[model samples]
Target: MSESIDIVYEALGRYIDGLCGSTYIGTARGMVVLYRGAEIHHLTPLKEPLPFLNLFYRKGTVEIVGVWREEKSEAFFLRAAAADVRLFEDERTISIITYPRTGDMQERGMLIITLHANMGMAKTLKSIIQEETRFIKKEEVVISSRVSI
Candidate 1:
């Protein structure tokens, strides 16, 4: 199963690179590695994969967070409008919130990504949603005065 997961991750990396023309970064255990056309970022064991959530976004950026098997869990959330990515853990779930990006209307758009994992699969399940928030427009008021102040 771990081998299959590795293949899946490799395929995912290739797919992402092909789609965005950006390099893919992967981690396992505690090491980090980068993948390009025919190159590898690191050669040492430190380049090995990690057992946590890996996030890919904005062409060449990847973020990873640690997870405890017995204590807590980790997940990734993305906000497209703000070009923001969030790493949420079990302890911080209450403080988790998504906001709009500056220079844009507060209700413009949002894209959310959530990841979940189990014990045996060695894979993560991702859920994505694209949505728009609507706001009511306010109209200016005009006052008329008949005769005199």
Candidate 2:
């Protein structure tokens, strides 16, 4: 069964695209990774300025966060938007880059996922994130009244 475990990753690709359906699968280390095709953004340095001159460290994890739409758990209620979901990170050192979370946090924090994947896989992931980052206008209307003297 271990030798055939490759299906897990394959399922993940399809799952993100809605082709895999509801049942979720965890990684070898007991964690499930997910993404929203409509909420990713390519953050510029203005928001996350490259603080200091790097002497050695270079590679970093790709960060993402949103309403969790995953397995059932207690953390679901913590998310302000949807009571049914919450975001989290696994202990996989090579895959996720997480930082300390603090205070009365309602929103699920970043995922810091990896982009150092195969070209096809990386592109698929990138596309999902990119599509969501596109700007779409929303219309708003305001009402006003005039007073007669």
Q: Alpha-carbon error at 40 in model 1, in Å? A: 41
| lDDT tens per residue, model 2, 20-87 | 23221121111212222344322111122221110110011121211112221101000011111122
| Each candidate's clash count | 7, 0
**CA deviation > 4 Å runs, candidate 2:** 1-19, 22-103, 106-109, 134-149
In candidate 1, what residue range of length 10 has the lowest lDDT sum?
140-149
lDDT of each: 0.28, 0.22
The alpha-carbon deviation from the true structure for residue 114 of candidate 1, after best TM-score superposition, in angstroms, is 1.2
Largest TM-score belongs to which candidate? 1
Candidate 1 whole-model C-alpha lDDT, 0 to 1: 0.28
Q: What's the lDDT for residue 77 in model 2?
A: 6
What root-mean-square deviation over C-alphas does model 1 reach? 22.1
lDDT of 2 at 43: 19
